[model samples]
Target: MDGEIRTRFKTICVYCGSNSGNRAVFSDAALDLGRELVKRRIDLVYGGGSVGLMGLISQTVHAGGCDVLGIIPSALMPIEQISGETIGEVKKVSDMHERKAEMARRSDAFIALPGGYGTMEELLEMITWSQLGIHDKPVGLLNVDGYYNPLLALFDKGVEEGFIKTSAREIVISAAKANELLEKMELYTPRHDQVASRTSWELSQLGYSKPPI
Candidate 1:
């Protein structure tokens, strides 16, 4: 196992949609997560923007007196529609690679709200990094309305097919509610952590280089 639970997160990275999805609860989860982060006094690190679920959480947490750091890629500014409404310090990076790197570097842990490809990309990258030992921070899903159930099923499929080990699959934490998820994250300890010490090049043939992403 990794170790004892971390007492303080300091900052948490969140990946979410630039567009609020079809459901009100998706937005509700975003707001709820924002409030939960504030309640815990954890700063927010996320894809930078002032719209959709991203905006909701950033504005909510910032309003609640928590620092928010928004890291964005230059290529996505026009796509995410950056505006004067941004709630916190915004750092511009060259591309998606830089943006993801910065978010992972700044966050103590990660949370994913309902989103699209970009959101999934960020989430999966974090999970991959954890599996590769680039980072061992907790990675979680808000599973709003069981939105992520299909992904979970796919992961199970990976395990059953002998592509993903049972122990490696345990790194991800999922919950229906914000508080529950956060608690799970704080209590999480990494197993199979030693695999991270091996380079991806050495592990790729072992079918350990990446997740389903």
Candidate 2:
């Protein structure tokens, strides 16, 4: 057994909005992501709540008989908690920072669905972590309806400005479909170890993250 090699991804972390955006495509993408996880037998780790995209995905995955974990800060419960039944296990932490740490700790890969500020912050933080070598797990954007095009442009601009390295920009992988994204992420090899680290100033303000939902 000691010589046995395990599958690289058993559980995936998803960062999404507390509120579902005003687009049917967004909800459809979240549902597709959940269904894909179930089909792959991959569990879920995400912000705890039953409202918005979080609820839609978790519930979809749970209904498909997949294990789902929801982690949320105690204080944010009033705003993020689901009204009816919640799928799988739900963990409540003391604060937002703990919530994020718990989510990151339990996941093997990360995907971002179309969302608002909370989703952006969570997704960006994960990319930053990968950039800093805190973890080399794959981070992906669902990019539904090209919602993340602007964000991608921003990263490119950072590269153009000479602040972000060309290599660092590769930290984020994306796909329009859930299965394709997962497949790409599965093939992802950490290139960080192959290259020198960027300056601390370039990754300044990098530390523990707190999601604002």
Candidate 3:
């Protein structure tokens, strides 16, 4: 850990499956991401859970001396919790909307690990928020083992079909490995034009004190 490089992000929100995928690579990638965060002295904000990739990454980051925060919807608490051993600081929100909002407000950036509908939903919202100028934070995808290849391609297709603006395609920073993804995200700059002024968006309603300047 000598001469460790400092990261621009103080905390990053990670969206991953509550169920670890069939392959070991997914779990490995999640743990690797956690270690990278610790190395960079960055903390973690994630969906609250005590199983699967969520548990793996959270425990790894917490054990590495970095703060870990888990935000979960009240309805999911019973499903995601394990033996009454949720890690770090757990915040229970009233619903999914509040859960996602809290996660965004607490983190400086985001990373999406290979997951199912819920994970993709969270990732897409962050990207949409960036598109609308709600926040300029980097949104990264840990495309482990090419799991996200199709989704990435679909995004490209959107750009090609005119459904998505060309500039907005750069909103999702992606890489196959945790180290590479973090490196890419650290250098990410908001190149896309915002749909509206951030001030006009009334960000305080989402728990943000102020939008990124």
Q: Write the per-residue lDDT of candidate 1 for residues 50-148, one digit (tens) a residue.
A: 899999999999998889999878887877756566688889988887777778767789999999998998899888878877667899999999999
**1-213: candidate 2 lDDT, tens digit per residue:** 222223468899999987888878989999989888877878999998888899999989898777999988878878888467767898888887777767877788899998888888989988887887666789999989889999999999999999788888888999899988888998998775423343423322323343211
lDDT of each: 0.85, 0.82, 0.92
- Residue 36 lDDT (model 3): 92
Model 3, global lDDT: 0.92
The parts of candidate 1 lying over 4 Å away from their true place are 1-7, 198-213
The count of backbone overlaps in candidate 3 is 0
Best by lDDT: 3
Write the residue-wise lDDT of candidate 3 on 1-213 in tens digits. 774678888999999999999999999999999989999989999998989999999999999989999998899888998986668999989999888888988899999999999999999999999999998999999999999999999999999999998899999999999999999998999999899978889788678676665
- Candidate order by TM-score, decreasing, is 3, 1, 2
Clashes of each: 0, 0, 0
Q: Between candidates 2 and 3, name the one with more favorable TM-score.
A: 3
| Candidate order, lDDT descending | 3, 1, 2
What TM-score, over all chains together, does every model reach?
0.88, 0.86, 0.97
Specify the highest-TM-score model's number: 3
Error of 2 at 73 (Å): 0.4
Model 1, position 35: C-alpha lDDT score:
84
